[model samples]
Target chain A: MDIWFFLIQVLNGLQYGLLLFLVASGLTLIFGIMGIINLAHGSFYMLGAYLTFWLLQSVDSLLLAIVLALPISAAVGYLIEALLVRVLYRRDHLDQVLLTYGLILIFNEAQRMLWGGDVHGIKVPAALDWSIPLTDTLSYPVYRMAISAVCAALAVGMYLVIQRTRFGMWIRAGASNRDMVAALGINVNLLFGAVFALGAVLAALSGAIAAPISSIGPGMGDTVLIICFVVVVIGGVGSIKGAFLGALLIGLADTFGKVLAPDFASFSVYAVMAAVLLVKPRGLFA
Target chain B: MTTFIAGTGLHTYYGSSHTLHGIDFAVRRGETVALMGRNGMGKSTLLKSLLGIVNPRQGKVTMNGADVTGADTHAIIRRGIAYVPEGRGMFHNLTVREHLVMSARPGNDGRRDWTYERILETFPRLAERLGSLGTHLSGGEQQMLAVGRALMTNPDLLILDEATEGLAPLIRREIWHVIRSIKETGIASIIVDKNVNVLLGLADRHVILVKGEVVYDGSDLTPESEILKRHIGV
Candidate 1:
């Protein structure tokens, strides 16, 4: 066991954990706050990557691509929520699953049709192209560290919004009792739309930031979506803090498992989830 | 003396089972009305129907001269109606303060009387538990929080279903006292409870339901009245 290799893997785990937090946080918000089991959430992440890809090519600026992509993703989320997800409020989980599954199929095919079947890579911003020497032989990418910083800032922003603003109160109240919140004269549908849009933006941002690190391709969202479900379940469905913690745990487990036992790496996160569920069935924070 | 809100010819159903049949009820401005009935007689259903929590298959509900029948719950509530539902409907995860703050709004009539300080003063027990979670409070405390939460909305009409159910004697009296104080503010109220003697003193008029039908509606009856015993008593 090389100590330097292990330390590098830990840094990699932190980077991966932060990225997972961005995606999983939105998943928790959409599921917990709006009571929608949206399987199409990952589609937003994929769309974000593609949108950033297109924008970066056209605008030739990473900052502009990010700025434009947020609102674009949010607008798409608003339309989808109003037109389709709104009808599913009174519906059972099975109906939601069927509809969202159908959406996943549509999104997957659409990506394939538009972008072709080949995997694509995005260049890291010129400003963050440097690396920091971790050991005598190993160096860590600055862009990965930047992902952690941005995710931390977003986490702080989310906490402030949820804890301080009137909008946040409505969300907290809605999460507890949708009917009661509506009866109190807060337009829950509007709140739902806004929260869904925020979720879309967050998911999109996750993809945007991660584009430089990972390959962008058709069906890229499927694996992330499954991992996020595991995160939400282990962290407690509605808790942002829980999602953050769960993501880190899975990130470390996945990173270390690969080096310790390569064959078990793929299933390690699931194993953690299973153990967490056995003790706290509702999730850690639920 | 004006009718603030009224529901007429209301027929509501839960899936295939009809819950309320042709129920007509009204609450006037500054008046206190008691809704009385046995279990499953549709007392709660009528309240829910008024707020659009459960839409009636037939009939109309008019509020402030507007036909609000089948309107969305939030829309109805925004029109100056607040409800304290049965089981208290307290959010298990929310703190007592959050419950109050979330629902706080100025009254539609331009009355800004029910502020946080006023609500806390009215229900001091709630003030002490401001930081406590809704699930942590006792039954009486939960009831107080629910009422305080409704008050914070500063609504024109406050409807409380099962107002004092599952309360101790002292707590029940305290609740009744608060209801009377609320009545003094000239806001209409519809209270549902089984404590006939206590309700008779506070409510200006009584509306009784028997198996989803109105058996009585008048102000002249008392706890000992024949009409009350005949319909409500076993």
Candidate 2:
């Protein structure tokens, strides 16, 4: 591939990598700290997209729709945790998988019924829709770059919370040794529930933001969810730093791999995972 | 400031293995009481039962005259009972300061003031490394942090199991310093430690268990007291 083509592909990968970080960060936090394997996490992403589709039509403004949908998404996330996820917290992983798989089905069918199977897209807010000039006949959409920037910001915020805040300590502590936290007079059940809600909100926000660039359709969440799993596996399961690096690596590889060998695009993503596993069985960051 | 925190006729199990068999025990308010037994004699199991972790198959647990047998862990906590269990149930990923915050309840359980700032003052080693993770600390520091966290809850009774099971002499002494200070605050404690010498010095009364039942309840201990040597050490 030519150098210009390679650079463009690299940026494309970065964009994908950034988005993957958003999803994988949530998955890893829930899995690592809470010991929960949340298959329906992607459903929250789908919920965000569907909400975007409906709200965009209702308000006729992408910014307003997203602004309005953010809190609503957070609330739905809380409900899902309180009603569904909490029930599975103490149960075996096999049962959690079965229940969350049930949630996946319910959310997928629910999204289809609400928004229909045909894909839809929200117009990027006018201010963010313009492209950044790179070369003659080569311009990148500002909205896609915006997705990368927004996800990057959230990642930084997540890092700060985990590193600097007291709640972050409890979260980390609860994940590593919950029994100790409980013994320390911490209401560990409350802590775990809050963490689960936070994970859901992140997944929802990722879906909402990506709506302008990607199709907001029935299975949009499923596609992203699989890619997110790839990100987490390549990062370590509970490592946020791992998720961040994994997302970027996967983003770059998937982007370039598709351009270099269209047939090997999917294989290339798995290939990187296999190669990383060979070096560190957990992932690049785990 | 403290009164009776007692478990009467406690029978508990983990799934199928029945562990605590009709064990009746009580710690007087503002008293330092020890729950002692050999390895796997249900010492930890008794603590777990008190926390409502494993429900008693029979009997009642009362805290400050309230029947807490049917209460959930948090409900029991809101009733002013704090538990520090064995093997240090800590979050390895969190910083020291964060550990304090996550455990801090809004307002005090009953204390007028038991602030996180006060905790840092109590454990200066933790203050120096405020951002360190749980595993990064030495065994003694982890134990100190555990006590600091329970203190943060400002409960009426602090239930600590195996608080000094494994530690250097100096670290154990440091823990004793903190524990004595806690008693000065008038927070009652049910402490499970192997050090009979320390127990005689600190505890107001002693609850000795042979198997799962209370074998001896002794009181009025002095430095010269040798009555505890047989029941406690051997």
Best model number under DockQ: 1
Per-residue accuracy of model 2 over A207-243 as CA lDDT, tens digit each: 8888777777778878888989989999988889999
TM-score of chain B of each: 0.97, 0.90
Reference-based TM-score of each model: 0.95, 0.89
Instruction: Tell me the lDDT of model 2 at A3.
Output: 66
lDDT of each: 0.90, 0.80
Counted clashes in each candidate structure: 0, 9
Superposed model 1: Cα runs more than 4 Å off: A1-5, A278-282
In candidate 2, position A99 carries an lDDT of: 85
TM-score of 2: 0.89
Which candidate ranks first by lDDT, i.e. highest?
Answer: 1
Model 1 TM-score (B-chain only): 0.97
